[model samples]
Target: MGPTRVRDLSVAAVAVAALGYAVVTLMYRHFPPITALSGMSLAVVALAEAGWGFYVRAQIKDGHIGIGGGRLHPLVVARSVVVAKASAWVGAGVLGWWVGVLIYLLPRRSTLRVAAEDTPGAVVAACCALALVVAALWLQHCCKSPEEPPDDAEPAAE
Candidate 1:
C-alpha cells in the first residue's frame, strides 16, 4: 500500500456521501421533492468543488511552492491555486446557501500576465495563492496561525 493524500480522501468521501444522499432523496421525491432536491444539489456542488480542490493541491505538490521550473508552468500554477481557493469557497457556499453570491464576488480574470520572466509572475501567483488559501480556511472554520509563541517557552524543554 502507498501513502494516501488526506485532501484526496476527504474529497472522495464528500462525493460518495453526496451520491448516497442523492439516491435516498431520489427515492423519496414524492414526499418532499423540492426541499430534498435542493439539499441534494448542495451536496453535489460540494462534492464537485472539493474534488477540484483536492486536484489543484495534488497538482502543485510541495516542490513548486515558490513557482520555480516544473511540469506545471507558472501561469497554470497560479490558475490552479485560484481554482483551489474557489473550490474551498464553493464547498462552503454549497453548505451555507451562499455559493452563488460568493462566486459572483470573485475576480474572474488573471491578476497579471507576462511571458517574459522580467517580472515575478510566479511570485505574484504564489502570493495570490497564499491569500486565497488563508481566506478559504478562515471561511471554513480553521483557526488562523498563532500570532506569537510564548516568549518564555523553552524550545519544548527538549
Candidate 2:
C-alpha cells in the first residue's frame, strides 16, 4: 500500500468537520458538555506511537536489531505504518470536529455559561488532536526503510 497523502487527510478532515458542525448545531441544546478528558484516549495513543517510532528508528539504524534472532520484524514495521496512517486520519477528523465545536461556541460564550465552560475543553481537545497528527506522521516517517525512495520522488537509476 502507498503512504498516506495530505490531500486525503485534508478531505477527511473537512468532511468530518462539516458533520461535527451540523451535529452540534442541531443538538446544541441537549448536547453534553465537552470535557478535557474527552481527548485522553487520543493523547495516550499519540504518546505511545511517538515513543515507539523513536525506538524503532533507533533500533533499525543500529543494524543490530534487525539481524539474527533479534531481527526487527517486517510485520511490525508494516503494522506501524498502518497504525500511523489510520491515526493520522482519525486525528485530523477529531481536530476538525473540535474546530467545529469551537466555531459554534465562541460567539455564544458570553451569553451561554455552558458554552464558556465547554470552550476550554474543546480547545484542549483540538490541540491534542493536532499533536496526534504530527506524532503519527513522524511515526510513519520513522517506519520507512532507509533504502526506499520517498513517495513523491522519482525512482533512482538501477
Candidate 3:
C-alpha cells in the first residue's frame, strides 16, 4: 500500500472537527469538566512511537534484520507501518476535534467560567495530538527501505 496522504488526513480531520463541534455544542453542559492532564496519554504514545522509529532506523541502517540477534520479520515492519498510519489518522482527527472545541470555547472564555477553565486542557490536548501525528509519520518513514539506483543509470568514472 502507498504511504498515507496528507490530504486524506486533512479531510478526515475537518469532517471529525465538524462532527465534534456539533456534539460539543449540543451536549457540553452534560459533559464532565476537562482536566488539564486528560490528553497526556497521547503524548506518551507519541514518545514511544518516536523511540521505536529511531530503533527501527538504526537496525535497518546496520543491515541487521532482527531484534536482539534474532531475524527481524518483514511482518513486523509492515505492522509498524500500519500502526503508524492508523495513529497518524487518529491524531489528525483528535487534533481537529480539539481545534473545533477551542474555536467554540475561546470566544466564550471571558463570559463563561467553564470555557475559561477548559481552555488550557484543550490546548494541551491539541498539542499532544499534533505530536502523535509527527511521531507516527516519522515511524512510517523509518520503515521504508532504502532506494536503489535505476538499472539504466550510468556508472561514474573512477
Candidate 4:
C-alpha cells in the first residue's frame, strides 16, 4: 500500500512538473532567443525525459492500477512510448538540422546575440541545437538493445 501510494505521488509530481514546464516554455515564447548551453540543455532534458518517460510508461504498462482505475499492460505501453520517443527524435532532428543551417548562415556573432536580437530566430536556432544534441544522444544510446545474454554463456534449457 505504501509503495503504491508513493508511486502515485511520484507520478502526480511528474505530471505537474511537465505541465509547469510547458507553461514556462509558453510564457517564454515571446522572449529573447536561447543560448547554446540552454539549447543543448533542452535537448538533453528532452532526451532524458523521453528515456525516463519510456521507462515510466513501461512501468505503467507492466500493470498495477492506473490513477484512473484500470488495468494496464507494460508491453503495450512501452511500445507506444517507444513510438512516441522515435517521433520526438525525428522531429527534433529535422528541426535541429534546419536551425543549424540557419546558424551557419548567420553572421559571425554568437547565437545568444541573435536570439536576444530576434526572438523567433533565436528560438528556432536554440531548438536546432537541441535537436543536434538529441541526435547525438540517440546515436550514442538509442540503438542499444536492453536485453542480452549473460557473460557466463549458460545455454537456456530447451
Q: Is 2 or 3 the stronger prediction by TM-score?
A: 3
| Residue 88 accuracy (lDDT) in model 1 | 53
After superposing candidate 2 on the true structure, give the runs of residues whose Cα lies further than 4 Å from its correct spot.
65-68, 148-158
Candidate achieving the largest lDDT: 3
Question: Relative to the true structure, how large is the alpha-carbon lDDT of every model?
Answer: 0.38, 0.87, 0.89, 0.45
State the lDDT of candidate 4 residue by residue for 1-158, as single tens digits.
Answer: 01112243335434544554455345544534444443445466556555755555454445452454554444544454455445444445444433443443344345445434554454554565445434433433433334655777777789
Error of 2 at 54 (Å): 0.2
The 10-residue segment of model 1 with minimum total lDDT is 96-105
What would the per-residue lDDT of candidate 2 be over residues 5-98, giving only the tens digit for each residue? 8788888888888898999999998988789988778888899999989988986787635545877788888899999999999999998998
Error of 1 at 12 (Å): 28
Candidate 1: lDDT over CA atoms?
A: 0.38
Which regions of candidate 1 fall more than 4 Å away from where they truly are?
A: 1-33, 62-70, 84-158
Candidates in order: C-alpha RMSD to true structure: 19.9, 4.5, 2.9, 14.3
Q: Write the per-residue lDDT of candidate 3 for residues 52-93, one digit (tens) a residue.
A: 999888877777665566656778888999999999999999
Model 2, residue 3: displacement in angstroms? 1.6
